[model samples]
Target: MRVLVVEDHAFFLLGLVTALTGHGHEVVTAGEPYQAEKLLGERRPDVAVVDIKLPPTHSDEGLRLAALLRSHEVPVLVLSQYAVPEYAISLLGADPRGRGYLLKERVAGVAQFMGALDRVAAGGTVIDTELAAMVTRAAARRAVLSPLSERELEILALVTEGLTDRGIAERLVISVHTVVTHVQSVFRKLDLPKTPADNRRVLAALAYLRNG
Candidate 1:
């Protein structure tokens, strides 16, 4: 895959470039949002890995870049040390497919990080499970939507992580029937239709991300 990496940290940026190259990807590096924008105009990459903060402003520059990339139909994977649910929410305002939010510390393993990149490149959202949980909890506390019970919230988080009903049941130590019931309740509360399981999960996740 051809990738554009937008990050301000010099050493980490070089390390990421090396890692992606080692994994048989062509990489272009940018230290700031403007540089990344210039590169985007010149060459289209399969995916863009962007930091949520950048030089000059150190604010939402990366968020704006991600929005621009999405407008051009480019996939984006945002990386950050902080969960910053707000930032994730902004990046996901576009199409859910080809979007990801990964915590930097969790990406120390090359294989796992590359796997996230591959998932985004293939048009799948790959949010960190921990971050997703935090976001969901915050949303529940806010009551922006109907509040979910603890068990229901847990099932929703697992659903966002792409786990199967049986997997969620096993992880939560609940029966498959119970998991199915929780899932149905979650969909109803979130106002997500009883469509395909995957679509329901995506819509539920979008609600959690938006309201959280």
Candidate 2:
């Protein structure tokens, strides 16, 4: 797949580009958002892997780039050292599909990281498992209404990991119906009025992060 990478750290950027290229994927590298935007305007990419922080601003350049890609209907996978849940939510605000948020340290295994990129490029969300748990715990702490059960919280974490109900059920060795019920309970406890198909997950994630 044709991919674009936007990162500020020179070594990290070079390593990622080299790794991706070695994986047999066409890679384009950009040090900042402006260059990434220019590349996007010139040729649309199958996927964009962006760092949540960048040069000129070092604040939210990657977030902005994700928004730009979303507006253009391009897929995006965000990589960051910190579990900045707010930034992840923003990156996915435009379109929950074909998006991902992964912690940089989690990419230690090239095979795993490349698999995540492939999943995002094929229109799937792939949040890091560790970050998902962190966000879930944060949500539990900040929750105002009813509190989530430990089991419910676990299910929610799995949800943020981009697992389908069936996949979650299989992983947990529970029935699909049980998984669905737990998910519903989680939303209700969190006062997430929106349907699961909507962006309620984002709210839950943000709340979790805030509490943390």
Candidate 3:
């Protein structure tokens, strides 16, 4: 895959570039948004892996750039240094197809990072489990997650990470049958609202968790 990586931190950028290239992905990189925009137009990469903070203002420039990429029908997977639900929700809320939000630290997990990139490029949503856990914790604070058992809470957090039953089962070292049963139990307990985007069960769950 051809990837456009936008990051300001020199060290992080170098490591990311190395990782992408090592993973057999063609990589184009920029230290800031302007160069990133230039590369985007010139390279026309298959996907973008953007950092939510950048140089100059060091604020939301990366987010704005990601939005522009999305407008041009480019897939984007945003990386952040912190677990901010608002940032994650904002990025994930706008035409979530081919979009994702994950923590910067997750890059160390090469398998996980590669998986997220592939999924986003294929028009899938990927949220960091840490951020998902934050949403789930907030749900508990609001008594929204109170009905779930301990194991159910664990599964629900993974669900927000956009994991399938099989993926969750593998992660928890359990059977897919058990995973399916637990997933059903989770939704049944929470009774999430009926969402128009049937495939976006994660977003629907997030919306309820964040706003409930």
Give the whole-model CA lDDT for all candidates, comma-separated: 0.78, 0.78, 0.84
User: Candidate 2, overall lDDT?
Assistant: 0.78
State the displacement of the C-alpha of residue 167, model 2, in Å, after optimal TM-score superposition: 3.6
* Per-residue C-alpha lDDT of model 1 across residues 1-212, encoded as one tens digit per residue: 99999999998888888999999999999999888889989989999999988988898788888888988889998988887666666677735678888888756788978977887887777777877677666666678545578788788877776455776788889899999888888878876757554523654575655654
| Model 2 lDDT tens row, 63-156 | 8878888889889999888876666666667457888899997666899798878878888777778778876665566663236677877887
Off by over 4 Å in 1: 139-152, 161-185, 195-200, 206-212
lDDT of 3 at 122: 88
Question: Candidate 2 at 205: error in angstroms?
Answer: 5.5
After aligning candidate 3 to the native by TM-score, how far in Å is the CA of 196 from where it should be?
Answer: 10
Error of 3 at 183 (Å): 2.2
The lDDT ranking, best first, is 3, 1, 2
- Arranged by TM-score with the best first, the candidates are 3, 2, 1
The TM-scores of all predictions, comma-separated, are: 0.79, 0.81, 0.90
How much is the lDDT of residue 67 in candidate 2? 83
Clashes of 1: 0
Best by lDDT: 3
Q: Weakest 10 consecutive residues, lDDT, candidate 3?
A: 192-201
Off by over 4 Å in 2: 142-147, 173-177, 188-191, 194-212
